[model samples]
Target: MKIALIAHDKKKQDIVNFTIAYTEILKQHTLFATGTTGKRISDATGLEIHRFQSGPLGGDQQIGARIADNEMDLVIFFRDPLTAQPHEPDISALMRLSDVYQIPLVTNLGGAEVMIRALDAGFFDWRKLQD
Candidate 1:
């Protein structure tokens, strides 16, 4: 499965820790992430991730494109809801695309944990049928 990992500034550490804990399960699949988040995760977990521009610079849109093209299966985005984001529109569009394409999107640590566990348990194998 192709998984996109994204996180806001304040949530970066949370995502990094999540990836570290799930490195074994995550390394089995293709990983994609926004610039800084990718660097952080790769550094902490030693996982190979395809990196795009920073979210404010269009990374969210890039991943959204993959979702629109049916090239991405899941999204694990750690959003910082308490903070104001300069790229709110891009973020909203990315999320809307995930919904429009019926992709599995996880927005917080709790949800991400459950989704990653499900991924490990083959609950998402049905996504292969869509290919």
Candidate 2:
């Protein structure tokens, strides 16, 4: 499965820790992420990730494009709900596309843990049918 990883500035550490904990399962699939988040995850866990622009700069939209095209299967975005984001419109658009496309998205660690486990268990094989 192709997975997009994203996180807010304040939530980067949390996402990084989540990635580290699930490195074994995550390493089995292709990973994509926003700029700084990708760099940080790669640096910390040594997982290969295709890096897009920083989220505030356009990474969210880039991933949304993939969703629109039915090219991305999963999204793990660690949003920081406490803080206001400058690129709110883009974030909304990305999420909207996810729903429109019927792609699964996990906005927090708990959901991500469940999703990752399902991925390892071949529950996502249905994604291949869409392709």
Candidate 3:
């Protein structure tokens, strides 16, 4: 399964910590992430990640494209609700694409944990059949 990861500046550390805690399960599948978040996660977990541009620089749109094309099965986007983003449209588009594509999307730590646990349990294997 291909998992797309994105994190706002404030939530990057949380995403990194979460990835570290679930590195074993995460390592079993392909990983993709936005620029700084990808580097942070790779550094913390030592997991290879395909990196896109920074979110404001078009990374969110890139991931949205992948979701639309059915190239991604899961998306974990740790957004800081209190903070305003310059590329809000990109973020919104990504969320809409996930919904339209029927992909699992995690927008907070709690949701991310649930999705990660499900991934660990192999709940995402059904995606292979659909592919």
Candidate 4:
């Protein structure tokens, strides 16, 4: 499965820790992430992630395109809702694209954990039918 990862500045650490804890499961699939989040996750978990530009610089749109094209099976976006983002439109687009495509998106640590667990359990294999 192809998994897209994104994290707001404040939630980067949470995403890193979550990735680290689930590294074994995640290592079994392809991973993609936005610039800084990808670098931070790679540093902490030693996972190979295809990195795009920073979110504010179009990384969110890049991932959104993948989602729209049905290239991505799941998205884990750890957003800091309490903070304002300069790239709010990009974030909104990503979220909207996920909904439009019917892809599973986890916007918080709790939901991300559930989705990762489901991935580990092979629940996402059926998604291959959509391709």
**Candidate 2 or 1, higher TM-score:** 1
Q: Which lDDT values do the candidates have, in the order given?
A: 0.96, 0.95, 0.92, 0.93
Show the colliding residue pairs in model 3. none
Question: Please, what are the lDDT tens digits per residue for candidate 3 over residues 9-119?
Answer: 999999999999999989988999999999999998899999999999999999999988889988999999999999999999999999898898889999999888877
| All candidates in order of lDDT, best leading | 1, 2, 4, 3
Clash pairs of candidate 4?
Answer: none
In candidate 2, what residue range of length 10 has the lowest lDDT sum? Answer: 122-131
**TM-score top scorer:** 1
lDDT of 1 by residue, 56-118 (tens): 999999999999999998999999999999999999999999989999899999999999898
| Residue 94 lDDT, candidate 3, scale 0-100 | 93
Alpha carbon lDDT at 122, candidate 4? 74
Candidate 3, superposed: residue stretches over 4 Å from native: 126-131
Query: Candidate 1 — worst ten consecutive residues by lDDT sum?
Result: 122-131
Could you give candidate 2's per-residue lDDT for residues 1-131 as a string of tens digits? 89999999999999999999999999998999999999999999999999999999999999999999988989999999999999999999999999999989999999998899888888867567778
Clashing residue pairs in candidate 2 are none
Candidate 1 structure, TM-score to reference: 0.96
Q: How well is each residue in 6-55 modelled by candidate 4, as lDDT tens digits?
A: 99999999999999999999999999999999999999999999999999
Error at 104, model 1, angstroms = 0.7
Candidate 2: stretches off by over 4 Å: 128-131
